[model samples]
Target: MVDALLDIAGLRAGYESTTVLRDIDLRVEEGQLSVVIGPNGHGKTTLLRAISGLVTSSAGRITFAGQDITRMRPEAISARGLVHIPQGDALFPDMTVLENLTLGAFLRRGGRAERSQQLAVVYDIFPRLAERSSQRARTLSGGERRMLALGRGLMADARMLMIDEPSLGLAPVLVDEVYRQIARIAESGMTILLVEENFSRVRDLADRLTLIENGEVRASGTVQEVLADPAVAATYLGIES
Candidate 1:
């Protein structure tokens, strides 16, 4: 995959002998908004953890930008432009929004000038963050917290963002806003591997769709290609085809 931003082959990851992801293989080409959707506890989060180096793979190959990162530390992997925003508010709740956003750029080798530039981009994307820069992360609403999380990732200057459940808990209006912002992020040229349960919200935004079940890739292709399968409907969506 000469142009792939991220690639995984024969990936196996687990926790203390309990394997969560088994023999998994996936790829996200440069500038594509690819999604992985499945039922709960089906290794969706584990897959993202593995790629982000939070969970180590027992046997596999993970390549990012043509570099082998199978055994790289989470920080090292992140430094190389792969940022993972885990599922939920993985932020310092007591910290101000500005503080959380600034911490995201800590791993970068660049100095304050570069960090400032990244912050500018994040604030541009989510002006709400700029407005509430001094407020604690815990004080924000659900949708505002999500926006802050995403803004923090942008502050890290991510080339590929592996985000888990951007719309986990929110009202219908907030979900729409979050999805709209996500679509804008993709439009702004970031390769995204999103794990979202709200398939309806992302169906139109994703360039490719992958269905993961029981630790394996059960289906993958263009959104239409994956969704049109009878197996996907019957197995994941509970719809008889």
Candidate 2:
């Protein structure tokens, strides 16, 4: 059996009085790239937020590496190596690129040399970050900022990385580059749970695909299986299968 690194069953969560996600069930296997694709306002971001403990689940459970983490605090969860790289590339605008990257290792338990080794790995993945290490985060271009955000997450040395819409707000060329980097990351055997608004962006990268519509799981399976589902073809692909 495949080892599931992150599993959610019957999950329900939302802000105050509004319920955004209902009975969502998903699984991301270890060392595989799982993609969740949905339209905007359909609870894609909310799903990630709830998993990372940014939003509390009203019901159901979230399990990571066989541990029940439904009620764990966000920081505590993050410290366990499940890192959430939120959409909008939430970097410290005033901080230098290097400083922001360094902050990602705050929860990591390691000596300086170990941290330096991780930083070197990130730089190797995103050479641009090393080139602009002294530059303020706010001054970098959108693509560069996205790279910094990814590099910062790598600094955490997460066992499972949950990324929210890595291609948001980027030109087509930049989107390609970002996805290329993501593919590279996956090639290195990192477990990734990636969210994307556009299905085309993740179609080739996903080892498994889950389609979410209006805060609920519509279909999930291997990429081909999900894409071949009749309902998915009609509603998502605009073609009747």
Candidate 3:
């Protein structure tokens, strides 16, 4: 088998006095859609933050595409094509949707032609964003905002995209639309690490599934392998069969 595109081993990170992730090891192959699912406050968000350089790691190593990025600054990491989209739709609400997406290419080394090409790619995946290009981000609907956030990430030309809580706080109908866009992104050849609280929306989308709890990995395997375990099914999934 080939090496994983993103390899994290013994990753431990947290805030001042609170250690959230402990000895976590995860690997994602190129072109795979991997997901980490768990209950709230179990360090799921922190895991993505650490990988994205938002939080510092006290121990362990993170290597992406054979480069050691454990201590690289967030911007430096992003320039190398690893991008993170955190929870809560972190957008410049006052800026026009086009402005926010242009910011995503801040670290990219390219001229207007290249940038426009990337913008076209994002717009193709999310035509709604193209339609609202001149509108302020704050004026978009809940689902549209999420799509804009995703479009901005694409502007970075990311090789690996780590997204936190893509389904949070959306109506069922909107959730379906957002997830469909994510699926389309994956199909376009970007490796994805999707972090979601519940599996109902993303259960069928992951190539590998990992369950995290109390700052540790409780289970990690193919979707069927992990979901078929009785304890995981009963405790988290509430599935009897």
Looking at candidate 1, what is the lDDT of residue 188?
93
Give me the candidate number with maximum lDDT: 3
Q: In TM-score terms, which candidate is top?
A: 3
Report, for all candidates in order, the number of backbone clashes: 0, 0, 0
- TM-score: which is higher, 1 or 3? 3
All models: lDDT? Answer: 0.90, 0.92, 0.92
- Across residues 89-147, which tens digit of lDDT does each residue of candidate 3 receive? 99999999999999988877779999999999999999999999999999999999999
Q: What are the RMSDs of all candidates, in order?
A: 1.4, 1.2, 0.9
lDDT of 2: 0.92
- Could you tell me which 10 consecutive residues in candidate 1 have the lowest summed lDDT? 232-241
TM-score of 3: 0.98
Q: Candidate 1: deviation at residue 86, Å? A: 0.4
- The lDDT-based order of candidates, best leading, equals 3, 2, 1
Tens digits of per-residue lDDT, candidate 1, 91-141, equal 999999999999988887678999998888888889899999999999999
Taking all chains together, the TM-score of candidate 1 against the true structure is 0.95
Model 2, 92-137: lDDT tens per residue?
9999999999999988888999999999999999988899999999
Evaluate residue 167 in candidate 3 and report its C-alpha lDDT on the 0 to 100 scale.
Answer: 86
Q: Predict model 1's lDDT versus the native.
A: 0.90
